[model samples]
Structure formats: structure tokens, C-alpha cells
Target: MKLSGCNLPGITVMVFVMLSSSSTSAITNFNVLNFGAIPTGGTDSTDSFLKAWNAACGTADSTFIYVPKGRYLVGPLAFKGQCKSSQIIIRIDGTIVAPLDYGVLGKSNNWFSFEDVSGVSIIGRGTFDAKGPSLWACKASNSNSCPSGATTLSFTNSNNIRINGLTSLNSQMFHIVINGCQNVHLEGVKIIAAGNSPNTDGIHVQLSRNVEILSTSIKTGDDCISIGPGTENLWIEQITCGPGHGISIGSLAKDLKEEGVQNVTVKKTVFSNTQNGLRIKSWARPSNGYVQGVRFIDSVMRNVQNPIMIDQNYCPRNENCPGQVSGIKINDIVYEDIRGTSSTPIAIKFDCSDKNPCTGIKLQNVNLTYLNKAAQSFCSNVVGKAIDLVRPNSCL
Candidate 1:
């Protein structure tokens, strides 16, 4: 089959010639260096990257855009596609550095973006370095003049994506974001940033489904993994998170059009020196959303504050949140086989919404303790049951 032209924003035309299954298969490799990409790390290579992406997107059959080892400087780049071929792979072994000046990135919220694409795979051990120290310092010092820094990597309105063996460092904002996507798989990824870096979430999933995050190590400022509104069927396992806010599903109900999240399972994760471990938080405002059928199992926490928390009145920075009860509903959640050392006395806190109280919460074999003292559980407007060997004594 000969795939033809498609239109994309900022792209005039895309021509792909895909081969049918019955036909002889051919794979094409487009190297970024061949497109005048300078690996000296001084010159901007954004145009070279765009050229390679365009070539791969326009090619017929399976295509690989290769970035070999070296340091290459680039600004914000977007790979938008409705490619002729379904298979477009980006194999990166080089380091891609973003400009240190946030002003140069202007208005673009992402350092590298893939949008409206399918059957895309980004693999290979590479680094995406967003020189974000200056940006972080500006934000830390209350310099309101700083521009909003960009996420290191983002996928928007894309599907059937696989990202593996990538290292993201010092991201200005979130390290990775999957937004309005489906059937995405991320494995063996690493994210690193300063604990005080503002808004530098490790991985954020929002408005997405059928996402699996496995064997990832994240050390960042904000939540290691944040599941936002409209996320469903998300499976996270074997994640090592530290020096961050830990994993969270939350701050929902800020938007009325937000959709509920369901069927999220996080298992076999470890949190060390994190602010909060295994948290579910929702804003105290009137908005329609719900979270249900969530499970956290076989997780270990060390020196974690708020080891197990459910805060329905989650107002950040004590911003004087409205007194209105949260409209988001929380139900059918389970925390099992969680053993942790808590940094605070209240290791388990369930502060549910006054209007829509959480129900069907189950705790099984949960052991959390503070230094030289048994941890405590605090419950408010929560309905739950404790299974066998529950520690810290459930207060439901």
C-alpha cells in the first residue's frame, strides 16, 4: 500500500509510502548528522532535528531517525505527524541540551514534543539535558519576571507510543508528560533534578489511558509520578523515587470538565526521603470528578513524610482554599503490603471530603512507624475497613 499526503500544523505536506504486509518490507534510517546537525554543543541543531523528523515522517515503510553520540544543542522542537507509515522510531544515543536561557524557548512549553502521531517508539540510552538551574533559581528567589520553563519531553494527542532507556536531567518543568494519549508504555527511564527545583515533576500522566510505567527511577522536586484527571488503566511497578513529593493522584476538581480516574494499580515501588509517599489528593472546590478502583501494593517507604495520605482538601502553599467541600468522589481504594518508616507521627492520614466522603477504603498489612514510636492514623469523613495485620491501627 502506498500511503500518501497528510497535513500538519507548521508542515506543508507529509508524504509516506508504506508497504503492505504482503509486499517486501524496507526500513529507512535518517541520521541527524546528515541533516547538518552540529554536535559541537555550541551551535543550535533544532533545524537539523526537524529535518530528520520530517524525513522520517514522510518516508514509506519503517523509519528510524538516529541521533548518534555527541553533545548537540537544540531549542524547542516539535515532531508533529500523521505520517504515511505507522512505524516511526527515534533512536537516540547522544545528549541533547536545551538552551539555558528560558527566553530563547519563548512561549513553547516543551523542549521536545511529539503530537498527533501513532506507532512511535523512542529508544536508546540518551540524555535530554535541560539546563534548568538558572530557571530554578529565578523561581526560587520569587523573580516573577522569569518565563515559565518547558517540560523536557511531552507527548500530546498521540497513541501506541513506547519510550525506553532515556535519561532526563534537570528539566525546567515536568520531565515527561503524556497528555491525551493512549496505549503508551515507558520503561527503564531515569529522571533526575534538584529536590528544590520548582514544578519539576518526574512523570505526569493526564487525560490518558492504557499507560504502563515500569522499572523507572525518578529523583525530582515535585511528584515522582503524578496521575491527573481522565487517567485510567494506569499500571506502575518497580519505581524507585526519592527526594521528591512521591507518587500522587491528585489536585483534581479544579476544572468542572475534568473526568474521573479509575483502575490505577501501583505495585512494588520504593520511596526514600520523599515528602509524601502514596498520596491521593484533591482540591477543596466544587468540580465534578471521581477516583475509584485504585490500589497500592507491596511498596516500601523510608523516611517518608505522610507515608500514606488522602487529602481531599489539598490546597497548596496554604493558599486559603475556599471553604466549599470538594465535589470529586473517592471510593474503592486499597493499600496493602505497605511497610514504611515515617518521618512524621501521622503516617496514615485520610482527610476525605465533607460533601462526598470516601468509601470502601481498605488497608491490609500496612506497617508504618516513626523513630522510637509507633506511627498513628488520622481519619476524617472516611469509611474503611482494616484487614489482617494492619499496623499503626486503622482509624476509619
Candidate 2:
């Protein structure tokens, strides 16, 4: 069946088609152009994209919402779920540009949000072009006057989600966020922003479980991948990160009753010219949380500031941080086959909390150097074991 198209001034004509039978389910294509989206890069295509999404969500058959190759301007969009069909795909071969003005986007925290979705896949070579230079300038000039910028893409309360082969650039905030999601897979994703862009984390995972990030490249200002509270069974592999804060687990212990991150593994990653390579940080305050069973293996670092670190006294600049020791318990952490060159002399630092010290910290096959000299290791308030060819080894 051929679906009707709406006509708008300066908009191209497109058609949607669906073919179905009693024995066979049809794959419907819902092109955004048919819903009054003008890809001239001038008109706001938010409402038109929403119309296409609504149609795709209400269709009983499998649907593919297509965004053709063009520059389409859009604003904040939320694609809510409980879709009529189990399978929904968004195929983008175009660039979606955000508005330059943050005030026009309002206080929304996300540019594109997918919530309560299952069996959904967003796959393409498209780009999310977040025009964030103005916002960054606003933030750099005056901290308090800067609005809360929006993440480029967000998935909330979603399960069985797959995001692959997409590029997100110059996000005002985080490039992508996976929150309260399960069984999500992100592969071959590219995230890029200025190294000085404030708070532009590559990918932030929070309150999620069973997530896999594979074969990705990220360069941003903040952490390449930040695993926040309540994440479990996360496997990150084959990632390349640089000009950013490297992969990290938590700046936790800020909340009174924060959830713990457990059973996370990062392997076969490379960090170049980043602030930290593999770090687990927590605030220096009394909080109820724990991080356990985490592993970092087979990683390479080049000119990284801190290659392997565990800082329990994490306090950002300009804040009057407390002197109390962190209450979070860290245990059963392992770092193996981590060979790196550090920008600083102190490559391996385990500055754990004095009150609740770290336990069962194991290091194996770790070789770190600085400027053709052996790097140093600093350990305090931690008990651990090192085995098999540890270089520049220190007391643990």
C-alpha cells in the first residue's frame, strides 16, 4: 500500500510504502519527507520528525523510519515507546543539526531521547551535529549564566536496544547517555568534541546493566566513557580514546544512598594524550556505596597523565571539599597487561579512602614509564598484590 504524502513549501516529495499478507508481515518505510520535513537546513523539522515517529510507532507491522541524506535542523525530540510492533528501526543517512541557541531548546536535558523501547535499532552512517560552540563560549565566560546543555542522544528505561555506526559531534553536553537500560549494545560508534568542551563526555552509562560498548572511537573533553552508579555487567572492548578523560568508573559517593557499580570490565583499549587512562574516583565525603569486581585488562596508554589510578579523594576545582574520608568500599579490582607511558612521574596511584580502605587490588604485567624513565607508583590506604613482571613497582 502506498501512503499519502504531505506537501510543504520548499519540501521535497517522498512516499512511504507497505506490503502485507496474512502469512507475511510487511516492512513499512516511513520516510520523514512524507511528513512535511524539509531538509533545507533552514526550517525546523522537529514536528515533522515527530509525525513520522508517531506513524511508525502506531504501525502494526515492522517499520523503518528513514532520514534521507541531507542537512535537517531539529530540536529536542522524545520518541516514547510501547510501540505497536516489536521491531522498529531508524535508518539515518543524513545529518541532524541542533539549534544554535540553547535558550530556544529550553531546559530539556536531551536532544533526542528514546524511552521504554524494546527491540529497537538505530543504525546508519548519520551524524548528530550539535552546534555547541556558542554554548561552550557561554559556559567558558560565565558559569552560572550557562544553561544546562542537552545530551546529543539519550536512551532511558529502554531494553534490547542497539545503536551502531553513528557519529556524534560537538555535543554541548554528553554525546550519548544510556540510563536505566538493559541489554543494550553500541558498536562502531564515533563520538567527537573539542578537547576543551566542558562536560562533553563521550558516552555516559548510568543505572544500566548488561551493556556492551564495542569497537568505538571517542575524543571529547570529559571521560571517554563514564560508568556511573548502578551499572553492572558492563563490557567495553576495542575502544580508542584521546584528548579527553579516559574511561572511568564513578565520581560517586556524592549522594547519601548511591547505588554501587559492579562486575564491569574494560579490555583492549587505547588512550593517547588523555588526562587519566583507567580510573575509579569517588568524592571525599561520607556516602553509602561500593564498587566491586571491576577489571581493566590489555590496555595501552600514550602520554597519559595518570595511567592507572584509584582516587577516593576526588574533588573538582573551586569547591570547598570536605576533609572526611570516603565511605564507599572498593574491592576486588584487577588491572592486568596495562603497558603505558605516562606524562607525569606518578603513573600508578592508589590513594584510597583512609577510613574504608581498598582491598583485593591486584596488578599483573603492568609496565609504565615517563620520558624514558621508569614511572613511580604511590599507594596509600590499600592492600593488594602484584604478580608477574610489574615494572616500577611500589609498595601496595
Candidate 3:
């Protein structure tokens, strides 16, 4: 610890950030409670935690809400703004279980919800078990009583969030969702899901900015990381992904209009048995959006299907590929220093739409070995390459 200097614009922020050189005081105090002591089995501990937190913090900008050891069985704990930009050490040696019934809320509920807050962290070695099979099965069967479960840990309309060293398993939907948030950091977390598990994505960040996902391991059914619309300045580094879909940006603007993703960087990552190593997906329709300033650098890939895919005609409802193109425009994308063994021979496929084609693309020192055969999409206006394979078909 050394002395630091800074100019203060706001006194509250000075106290909030605590950048003073001479102080030895820890910024936060612990308010510890064990759910096991409460004798609650389920998300009830979570509900109680919220109530206690509300009383403790009371909209005072933030507070450190500490949960010490013990097993807490809870379902879908919603945190709107209890610990905003504060040290929230729900320390390890504890389990937060989502009740057996609260299915993934793709359309409705978020298991762990955050809204309109900043400088918050959910840290330490804990487990968020979304005991989500009973409801998933019912929803899969099209039961009218079943609700949508799109994401397990969903962050909505917030900023400066951090999730570190946690384990999440058995999600009814996407393992983690960062939606409409900014300045988020996820470090040293492990998320697991089955390969055939429907929509079980590892980390899906949408409509956010300034996000960092580093040193995480993800195994899931869907893309390990899916960057969606209105997202910018995202960095993902040092991650071990797969037994799933590789890193992806977009499935952009599935049903919405005016969505754009920009300034994303993925570096020093490892992929194994994934479908696509580095992928960008945009709709086939002519929509009003653009993805710009994207880079994937220094990554290792193994046994991935279509190791690199740029699909503009994403999610075709009916084949014969439509003429109503997506309004989304992609620009200034770069992939550098990538070596990979692709499970499919269509190692690299660019499906840029005939209308509103991709622009300002650069691929340098990329070598791909695909076993699935090759079929290259027509790059009408595409330019630049150290591109190895573009075949979208199989060797068979």
C-alpha cells in the first residue's frame, strides 16, 4: 500500500472510492448471517436476506452484505440495489439453491436479478444451483403452466458489476445473462451444463458496455459467450470453454430493431469440442444495426465445428433463404493469431447477406483444419484474408 494522489470532484465519490493515501480503514463492514441458522430450505433464505439487506442499506448508495458459511436453499433471489458498488462477499463454503419450481425466466423472472445499480460484486466460492429439471421438462413439453426460463443469473439495466469464483449448475436456460448492464467483470467462475441442454448458454451479454470476462471455465449446450445487441467495449480473456458452442457475438436482433454490438475483444482463450470457435451471427433480414471494432486474438481451438462462422442469415424460419435482409451492418472486424482443429471441414464460413454486406474485415495469421468439408459463401464485397477455409459443407 502506497500513497496515491487524485483530484476530487465529488466528496461522496471520494469516500465511496476511498482513494486517500493515509487511511488504513477497510471501506466496508460485514453484516453476516447464516441461512442454516434460519432453518429455511429454499429461496426463502434469499428472501430473508433481501429483507434484511433492505433494512440495513435503505437506499444509502451501497453496503457490504456478507453471507458467511452455511447452506441456503433459495429460489430466484432478486437484488435491485442492496449492495451498489459495494463489497458483497457472499463468501464461499455456502450454497444458494434455486427452488425446484422457479423455471428459467426468459420471458418473465430472473433467478438472480439486478437492476439500476453499480459497483456491486457477488464474489467468493459459492454455488448457485438452479435445481431446474422439473420445470424445464414441463416447459419442454409445451405445458401452458410453464413459464419461460431464458437465463439463470440475469443482470438487467445496471453497471459496474462483478461476479467472481462462483459455480453454477443445472440451469433451465442460459447459465448467465448480462443484459443492459455496463462495466461488468466476471472472473474465475465455472458454469456447467449438458451439451444437448436447450438454450443453456454459458455467458450471454446483451445490451451492455465495458464488460470483462476473464479466467472462467464454461461448459454448456449453447455458445459459451454470446454477445447480443446494444453491446460495446466487451473483453473476454483467458477462458477455457467448451464441450459446447464457442464464443459468439450475435444472434443479433432476433425480434428487436435498432440493435448494434461493437468493440469486442476475445483473447488467449481455449476451446474444446465446441461448435464454433469465433462466431458472429446476424439476421438475414435488412435491419437497422451494426457490429464494429471486433477482435479475437491469440486463441487456441480444438475439435470445434465450423471453428469460425459469420452467419448473416441467422435463424432461418423457412429455407430458400429470404430476400428481406437484416438491417444490421457489421464493420471493422479482425481475427489474428488463431490456430485450430475444426471438427467440421467448413472451418470458416462467412454468410454475409447479399444486401448490407460486412465491411472492413481483416484476418491475419489464422490457420484452420476442418474435417467437415468445405463450402464457401460468396463474399460479394468482402475483402482481406489470411483466411484458410470457407467451405460451409462437409467432406462426405
Candidate 4:
């Protein structure tokens, strides 16, 4: 059976076709246009998209949801599953735009959320325009009535997922969030936002395992990639980041008993004019958390501030955890072949927790410079070793 058509203005249409007995023989396509979705981005297409998702998800056959070449205005959408079809693909050739007024999505949690899904692949050369400039202006003006912004895209409690070639622009908050998931891969993804936009992290991963982010370029205000607690076996490579905070692990130790982050590898990356190149930060609080078996290798930095850092007493603005010390144990970290130009005098800083000092930190073949001169290194409450021609005089 074949299904394809566009609906008339102000009319909602639902098309259904019976499949053959052997569903695997053919892949069915569910286009949102047939379900009354407006292509001009002037009207709400949330219901139309949801209907298409529901129909495609309910089928046991391999299904494809197609968003054709047009601009679609969508509201906050939650695509939940425990789907009947294990192999479902959503291909978008159009741009999905958020409401012109950021408040519509700002008050919500996520613009596009996928929860409890498995074996779903989203591949497209599409764009997600979140219209975040207004929200950033509001927050910049210290507007107390402003809502906490929503993430542009989020995947939670999902497994065997793949997101490829998707572009996110001007996100109100984070561009992509991977939480409570396993075996998720993101590749050839592009995230763009202003350099000073508040909290627009390119990607945030937490409570996930075996997640891979490869061949991605990010320009944002916050960390290009932020690794949170309970993330294990994450591999990030071939990434380009600039006009933002660089790759970071932690800001952990939030709770008294927190899950640790382990086995993360970030290599073959490049950073330019960023706030921090490679960092691991945590709040100064009494916690039973730890970070171990992390590696940062073969990365290049250009005019980045704090090329290498481990700030355990991360009490921003002296807010909470005043005078408190972090109890998080950070160990077994390696930085190899990191060559960089620092924007600051201190290229490397390791301010580890006094209660549980950092141990087994190794640096090899690190060359960093500041202002055409030799930079400096600072170490406090840490124990480590330097090998193979470290610059700025390793303070281990």
C-alpha cells in the first residue's frame, strides 16, 4: 500500500493503509504533510507530527517518518515509546522552528524529547531553530519573571539510538541532552549559538553508558560537551569547539551520595578561543563521588583560556558550599599530546580537593604557550607525574 498527500487548509486528515502479511518485505513511510501539518511554519504542527509518530510507532513493520522540505512550526513535543517497531527512522529535510516568542518553549522542559525508545534512528540534514535570542536577552537583563529555558532536544531512558547530521541553532538552553540512556551515538551533528548565550551547552551526557559523539562541531556559551555523573564508557572524537566553554567532566559532588563518572575518552578534538579547553570541575561539598579512568589525547587548542584544569573547589561566585571542601576522589586521569596556546598566564591548573586529593594524574607531551612566552602551571592538593617534555614546567 502507498500513502502520500497534503491536507487542505484548516483541515486535519489521517490516512491509514493496511500492510501485507510479511511486514518486513517493505518499509512504510509516514509523512506529516498527510496529517494536516502546515509547511509554512505559521501554524502549530505538534498534533500532526504526533499523529504521524503514533501511527509509525504502532506498526510492527519497519517504518519511516518523513518530514519533507519545508518549514514546520512545532511546539514542545514528547515522542514516547516502548514502540512496536524496533527499527524506526525519522528523516527530516525541513527546518523545525520553535515559537517566535521564546516563552512558549522556555517554560517547557524540552522542545523535542524522545523517552523510553529503542532502536530508533533520526537522520536528516534538517535544522532546529529554537529562537533563543529573546530568552538570552531577558536573562541578560536580569528579568526575574523569566522561566528556566528548555533543552532543544533530549533523549532519556533510550537505548540503541542514533542521531546523525542534525543541526541545532540558538537553543534556549542546552542543544542536546542524553540522560539515563545506553548505546546512543551522535555523529556529524552541528550545534550553533551565541558566545555569551546563557547555558547553551552543545551536548550534556549523564547517567549513560557507551555513548559516542563523533565528528561534531559546536559553538555555544557553555561547555561544548559536558559530561555529568554516572556516565561510563563514553567516547568523543573529531570534535571542533569554539566561542564556548570547552569539554568538561563534572561539576559533580552535588549530593552527599552521588554516582561517579568513569571510563571516558575524548581525543582528536580541536578548540579555538574557548573559555576552558579541558576541565574537570566539582563543587566544594561533602560527597562520596569519584571520577576515574578518563583520558584526553591528541587535542589541539588555539588561544583557549585554561587549556588544562581540574578545579575541585568550584564555588562559583562564592554561592553555596562556602568554605566547604569537596570529598570527591579524582584519580587515574591522563592528558597526552595536548598542544595549545593559552589565553591566560596559567595554562594548567589543578586545584584538587584537599579531603581527597587527586592521584595518578599523568601528563605526556603537553606543549602550551601564553602570549609568545612560556606559561605557568599551578597545583594544589594533588599528586601526579609529568612525562615526555611537558611545557610550562609541570607542577606535579
Candidate 5:
């Protein structure tokens, strides 16, 4: 496969083939715990499961702590460098629920939290239920008095995480979050929060590096993937997004200082009924950060607003926006293999600041068809046209 040419839903089914390579892989120990066979329905084995996992943390390619078919109630499961070399795989065959009133740990509403950990893999075909009714009620009554909710799963200050074949549902906040972590890989994951749910982003990644999300389907109330600050070498492929905002860069960013995001790529992804497509947003103030080397290739956008947007003047909370352009430059963005239908006429908009005009940007081999009409970009003050880019700039 041509790395960048593969389609979503196509590559996900082949995860086992590409992911199971023995080339410098994690160590393995198989400890199968059939939650159904154990006959412990009422008792929560959160600690027992962790004990079994720790005992089998030998260095091997197949270190698996399998949870076979049953509703096993668990508490927050944490992973650190200690479980790093174990190549951990928790094959959840059934549902994993939390104890009552724990509030799914720290999942949704207000700010979510993540403890420090690294080098883990949570791959399973089962469901992780946050069961967030109590938390929801609290939020419905008084947003201020409720305690912070926990996520169903979080990747915190950790690296080399591979999440596959899982249905992460009804998280208190974001379904999946990667924060202060590096070298993360998400494949064949499904995240679905309640419709019109508040702050329920499907996959929110922040302060991370070298992250790859592959063959995932995300449908949430918020952005399918909200890429936050300090991310580098982020690659997304074969993703199906809908019923939310499409792959966004940021909504709130302080400065272009330690907040640089580079080498971002989204390819072979299909977006349906999304708010935006191929979005890059930034705040205009003390100019604390920069976003560079962003690309969206081989993508299809449908019934989306703003199929392409580069908004430099972002902080949209106030009618009269503040902050002068502090020269947070954006460069090297590419939109190619784009075939879509947008509901709106002004489907493609790049509102880069005049002070810091979007430089080194290109739209190649690109054809955007919106409202039964074909469209091409008419940019202003761009460094290069779609064809004159340093990278190959073509539409065919």
C-alpha cells in the first residue's frame, strides 16, 4: 500500500497484519481471565485484574491480559512505564463499567484529567461504558457544583499506545484523549457520545508528538478530532467522520510559543454532515505559537460547512475581537484529492491575517464540487499557487 493512498475502512480490517510485526516489538505474557467464567458478577475486580496484569508483565510480543465475555466492573485503570515493555493488550470481550458514583473517573463536563503514564496498548472489541447519568444530572442542575468527571480511557504523558477494535461510548467528556504523550497510534476505534452532548469531543489530542489515528469512525457532538497545542508529526488516515466538527486544529490557543503543531496530515478520510473540513484555527494576540506543514490529501467532504478554512482571527467568544496580529505564521498546507459536495456556497474560505499572510500554501489536484457546482480556490497574497508548490501541485 502507498502509505498515503490507502482509504479508511479499507485499512482498518488489515490491522492485525500490519500491527503484529515482530520487528523490535513489545514483550508478551498471556494471562487469560474469562470474566464470564469467573462467576463474579457483583464483585468489582479492578484490583485483581491489575494484579494479574502486573504478574504477567514479561517482555514478549504477546503479553495479553484477556478479559473474556462478561460485564466486569472496573475502576480507573492506569498504565505507566512499568507496563511499557509488556506490549500490553487487554482483550475485552464484554462490557467494562465503573463503580457507582465514581463518575467514570474524569471523562466529561468541565476539564478532563489525565495522570502520568506511558507505553501501553488497550486493544479490544468490547465496550467501555462510562455510565454518566449521575454526572449528567449534576451538570443539568448546577454546572458549578458538580465534581469533575473522568474519561472512559485516557492517554496521559504516555507514548506508544495502540488502541484497536473498541467501542468507547458515553464518556463524561471526550471519548478518547491523548495528552502530553508521544508516539501514539489509534486504529479501528469507534467513539460515539450522546447526541447534542456537551463537550463530548470524539478524540481530543493535545501536547503530543508523532501521533497517528487510523481507520477510526468518530461521531460526537464536538469535533471528531480536536488537535490541540504542542503536537508534531500527527498523521490521520482512513477516518470516517460525521455528525460533528471535522478534523480541527484548535479552538483555544494561547501563543505561538511552545504551541507549535507541524507535520499534520489527514488522508483518505470521508466526512459527512460536519461543521468544518480541513480546519486550522489560531488566536490573534501576543502571537505565542505557529502551525506548519499541515496537509489534507485524498479526502472526500460531504454536506460540510467550510470544506476548507484557515482562520487566523479565531477566538470567537466576543463580538469585538481583541489582540493585534503578533505574526504567528502558517505555512506548507496542502489540500489534494478533494472531491466533495458542500451545503454552503462559500464552501472554501481561508481568512489568514494580512499581517501574517498564510505563506507556502498549496491546493493541488484539487476539485471541490459544492451545490452541483465545481469550485477552485481564489486565494489572496499566497506564496505559491496550487501548481507552483515545492511539493507536487496537481489536481489529476
Candidate 6:
């Protein structure tokens, strides 16, 4: 199937020629060195990287774009596709660094982007070092000239994608984003950033479906994994998160007309020294969004704050929509086999919206403590029940 071309930065046209299923084709290798990319980190390799991509994209055979072991400096890159081959692999064993001047890539939407691509896999133990501390410092100083930092990598309007064994360090914004895609899988990924770095979510998925994230470790400033509206059929397991905000859903209800998030499952995750664990939050404003059929199971938390939380009346900094109610409905959520130690006395908090209260919530075999003492549960505008063996006393 041929995908229509879209105008991409540094790209004139996209041509994809699909390979036949019955064909036995040899893998074509496109090495960045062959395209005049310098291995040293000082030189700009943007053009060389694009040249390699173009060469690989135009081929009918299976292709591999290889990045050898060295430090390489690159700027903003967009890999747009309707490629000739159905299978393209990007294997990287090098460290890719951004320019020292943060403004060079910080002002852009993303440092590296894949758009309108399909059947692609990125593998190997590569490191993406996006030197974001300068930008973070600029923002901390309250400089009006600071640009909104760019995401490290993003995939959009694509399908059948896989990312494995990649390390991202000090991303300017979100580390990895999956947007408007389907059948995406990410595993064995590591993300590291300062705990105070602003808006640096490890992974953010939205308007996507059938996504699976497994065996990932994240230590970031913001949510380790954030689920946005229109996300469905997501599975997250075996994740380790610390020095970050734990996995969250929503901050939804920003737009009046928004999509609902449903059928999400998070299991076997561990959190330590994090802000929150297993949270669902939405803005206190008018919206048509809803969250349903979500499950958080077999998770452990250590020294975390708000181990289980639902803040439908989330008004960050109490700036917008004071005294307003959230229109997003939340229901059919379950928490099972969650054991944790909370940093705060209140281990569980359900501060749902007064207008459209949360219902159909269930808790089973949950235990949480504060300073080795009995924790507490606070509830408001929520209707739920505890099945068995609930600590901190169920307030449903």
C-alpha cells in the first residue's frame, strides 16, 4: 500500500514501494559514515543523516540504517516515509548528541521525528543525550526568552512500530511520544533526567491504540508514563519509576470537545521515592471526555506520595477554573494487589468532581502505610466498594 506524501522538513517527496510477501530479498545496509556523517560530536551530521535515510527509503528491499559506535552531533531531523520496503530497521550503537547551544533544537517541536511511516523497528543499545540542563536553567530563571523545549523523539501518524533497548538522557521535554499511531511496542527502554526538570515526561501516548510498554525504567521530572485522551487498549507492565511523578492518566478536559480514554491496564509496576503512584487526573473545566475500564494491579510503591489518587478537580497552581467542576466522567476503575508505603499520611485520595462523580470503582487486597504506621484514605464525590483485605480503611 502506498501512503500519500506530506511536506516534511528537509524532505521534498516521500515514495514508498512495498515489497512482495513471497519475495526473498537481501537486506540493504545504509551506513551513515558512507553518507559523509562525521563520527565526532563536534560536526553537524544533519545532512548526512538525511541522505542516508533517503537512500534507504527509496529501495524496494529490506533496509537497515546503521549508526556505528561513536559520538555524533545532529540537529533537528524528520524521517518521513512512504518507503519502498515494508520493513526498515534503524540499528544504532552510537551516542547521538544535540548541539551545545540549546536554542538550536529547543525551539523546535521535536529533535528527532518519524512521521507517516509504517513497519519500522529501531533497536540496539544507543544513547540519545539531549543536553537539556541549560534550557531548564533558563526556564528556572524565569526568562521570557526561553523557548518551549522540544521533545526528544516523536512518532506520528504511523503504525507497526517497535523501539527496543534505547537510552535517553536529559531530554528537553518529553522523552518519547507516540501520537496518532497504532500497534506500537516499546520495551527495554531507559530514560533519565533531573527530578526537577520541567515537563519532561518519560513517555506520553495519545490518540493511539494497541500500544504496549514493557520492562522500561524511567527517572524523570514529570510523569513516568502519561496517558492522554483518545488512548485505548494500552498495556504497561514491569516498569520501574522513581524520582518522578508516577504513571498518570488525563490532565484531560483541557478542550471542550475531547476524546475519552478507555481499556487501559497497568500491572506489575514498581515506584520508589516518586510523587504519586497510579493516578487519574483531569482539569476542572467543561469537557466531554471520560475514563473507563481501567485497571491497576500488582503494583508496589515505596516512599511515594499519594499512592492511589483520583483528582477530577485538578487545577494546577489553582490558577484556572476556580470553583468549577469537571465534566469528564470516570468509572469502572479497579485497583488490586497494590501494596505501598506512602510519604504522606493520606495514602489514598479520591477528590472527584462534585458535578459528575466517579462511580463503579473497586479496590481489593490493597495495603499502604505511612512511616510504618496506619495510613489514611480520603474520598469525596466517589462511589466504590472494597472487596477484601483493604488497609487504611476503605472510604468507599
Tens digits of per-residue lDDT for model 1, 195-260:
988999999999998888988999999999999999989999999999999999987988866899
Q: How far in Å is the alpha carbon of 47 misplaced in model 1?
A: 0.2
Off by over 4 Å in 2: 1-25
The reply for model 4, stretches above 4 Å from the true place, is 1-24
Give the lowest summed-lDDT range of ten residues in model 3. 1-10
| Model 5 ranges with Cα > 4 A deviation | 1-42, 57-62, 83-86, 99-119, 132-142, 316-323, 373-384, 387-396
Estimate, for each residue in 139-180, the C-alpha lDDT of model 5 and write its tens digit: 778768676676667777875666778987777767888888
Query: Global lDDT for candidate 4?
Result: 0.90
Q: How many clashes (backbone N, Cα, C below 3 Å) per candidate?
A: 1, 0, 30, 0, 27, 3
TM values, all candidates: 0.93, 0.93, 0.82, 0.93, 0.79, 0.93
Q: Candidate 6 residues 1-396, lDDT tens each? A: 112221221111111221223243477778899999899998999999999998888899878788889999999999998999887878778999999999998889999999999988887789999999999999999999998988998999999888888999999999999999998888889999999999999999999998889889999999999999999999998999988999999789988889999999899999999999999999888789999999999999999998999998887777756467899999999999999799999999999988899999999999999999999999999999999899989999
Worst 10 residues of 4 by lDDT: 6-15
In angstroms, how far off is 155's CA in candidate 6? Answer: 0.3
Candidate 3: residue 200 Cα off by (Å): 1.6
Model 3, runs deviating above 4 Å: 1-43, 59-62, 82-89, 102-108, 139-145, 316-323, 371-381, 387-396
lDDT of 2 by residue, 1-396 (tens): 111211211111111222223333477778899998888899999999999998989998888788989989999999999999787878788999988677655368899999898878887789999888788898889868778889999999998887888999999899999999988888889999999999999999999988889889999999999999999889999999999999999899888799999999899999999999999999988899999999899999999999999999998793888777899999999999999799999999999999999999999999999998988999999999999988778568
Q: Write the number of the candidate with greater TM-score, choosing between 3 and 5.
A: 3
RMSD for all candidates, in order, please: 6.4, 7.0, 6.2, 7.1, 5.9, 6.2
lDDT of each structure? 0.88, 0.88, 0.69, 0.90, 0.68, 0.90
Q: Per-residue lDDT for 188-228 in model 4, tens only?
A: 89999999999999999999988889889999999999999
